[model samples]
Target: MATESFLREIGGKSVVEQIVDNVTNAIINGELKPGDKIPTENELCTSMGVGRNSVREAIKILEAYGVLTIKRAEGTFVKQGFDSKMLYPVLYGIILQKDSANQIIELRKVIDVGILQLAIDKLELESLHKAEQAMQKLEQKLAAPAVDINAIFEADTAFHMVLVAITQNALLEGICSYVDQITKKSRLKAIEKFINDKATERFLLMHRDMLRVVKEKDRAKINEVVEKHYQYWEQVTC
Candidate 1:
């Protein structure tokens, strides 16, 4: 009574990507519910009519995306939703250029501001205190004499990551992993070129203002500061 979808017709990486797409859709659409065990590797290979290597590769990719989990002595199981961490590196690798990084940062700004606005209503007192402490540390780092750009960059990352933590969303945290890695790499490259006191001061000042904005929890202000901060990297296209 049902129409059959043929997997054999799909080609190349398309076939592999198709496998991921099909399985992903099944999980997301509830056709393959979380915790539901999927067919065995051999069964999948038989159904897909693809080589065992293809099925294995597809499974690994799915596992990276958090769409499926494979356990020893058991088969693979679908997850309710893909985890952000699983998606981050892939997402980052897919968009690593300067322009794309800028765009991703812009997107993150919007998302983070919205998240922070919502979180303000639910931010734990301890969370606020922790954020405040991070801000203080950032201030001290900025005021100190010239140090390794790596140190400065790490502090900067911690500041934003702490703000993200306030939302208490594991998915958001994971999604940030790739973006953070790329951003840090780009930042180190950019700062390495400008380690002078003047450039360092400018960087420190921007971070100081960013920390102040986050602490205020002012939606509009935070968005503006975040945008400005991310725009800092837009000039590094070379």
Candidate 2:
């Protein structure tokens, strides 16, 4: 390949951006494949005729975005795919700033209800069994005289997570995990305030409704039940 001179005469911008763009375009154009080693820092310095520091800095920035992955003994390589770890810290930052809980919960209501509708179309026997198991566990936990806060939270998280898991979408599951982390404190607070025998029983009944609709493959029923159930949390969080 005839390498373009990324450091040529231009306005006084640094070569780092050109280097990053050239490399990124190469990866996007399939010139680079997953596990393909990036040019060594020394090699990039020589090829781009720039300082080693410039190349090193660009690589570091790209690696942070999930465009590249570095293995300790092995050299850097194009990433297999974008990973959620890239966005989780950013999501957590947004949550910590405490500006967007309602926005996030609203987004959750939209996405989660959509996932349940999809699960209705694609529900497998195994997924229903998993949901049932989660539900039964919730029942057992709720039967205790003094419910464990963490246990109830985990069961509730698992119950909703299963909805995304059964949809068989890795990205959706990753997103669910991210959102769960963002709202963990607020959700726990809501649970502390709103959870009781009545609330737990209502949730169990909602889960049963979801399972029944999924088992029957009724899209309308599944959508209705899921939206109603999830709206309960949105109201609480709001």
Candidate 3:
């Protein structure tokens, strides 16, 4: 296939950025398949009518996003894990830095509630087992004379993420990941407050009961528990 057929002359955008977009489009369009070597610098220059520096820098940008990987003897190959999502860290970081605890708690409630309803259809014992493992880890963390809030948060996040995983929705998982990332600091602060207030035991018990209701396929009860959990979380966090 001809490289010129895909790449175009750089317009208003910076030459490197344009090349990056073009190559990214190529990947999305499957013109550049996974493990396929990217066109050499000379070919990219000839195809896009850009300079060698532009092509090299463009390849570097793609590589930073996990889109392309350079080999010593070979060449740059399109990486398989090249989702646009790999670029979301900066955006999520910026948004999360500006977001408030209240806003995060509100978003958490909405996203969790929606996912819980959807999860009921495909709920299985194994899924419940995963949740139970995570919950037990949380309990163990809290039981320590000196609780590690971060460990508690990790366990809590795992339990919640496992619930969503049962639905097997990639987009949903990605969105939840962003929410989880954004809420990390807030969750830590809230957990610290909740622990000092001696509310950790009730929280852990609620989650254990949550596992029970989910295993029982009790959607109505689980929904109520989820709503109450978020509310209690907000009271502590906000």
Judging by lDDT against the true structure, name the best candidate.
3
Question: What TM-score, to 2 decimals, does candidate 2 have?
Answer: 0.77
Clashes of each: 0, 0, 0
Q: Per-residue lDDT tens digits of candidate 3, residues 106-140?
A: 66677776777777777877886787788778788
Q: Which segments of model 2 are wrong by more than 4 Å?
A: 1-31, 46-50, 72-74, 89-98
Which sections of candidate 3 miss by over 4 Å?
82-90, 93-97, 100-122, 164-182, 209-213, 218-227, 232-238
Q: 148 in model 3: Cα distance from truth in Å?
A: 3.7
Per-residue error (Å), model 3, residue 150: 3.4
Distance (Å) between predicted and true CA of 235, model 2? 3.4
Clashing pairs in 1: none
Estimate the TM-score of every prediction. Answer: 0.77, 0.77, 0.75
Off by over 4 Å in 1: 1-14, 46-53, 79-85, 88-93, 96-98, 189-205, 208-215
In candidate 2, where is summed lDDT lowest over 10 consecutive residues? 1-10
| C-alpha RMSD by candidate, in order | 4.1, 3.7, 3.7
Candidate 3 global Cα RMSD = 3.7
Q: List the residue pairs that clash in candidate 2.
A: none
TM-score of 3: 0.75
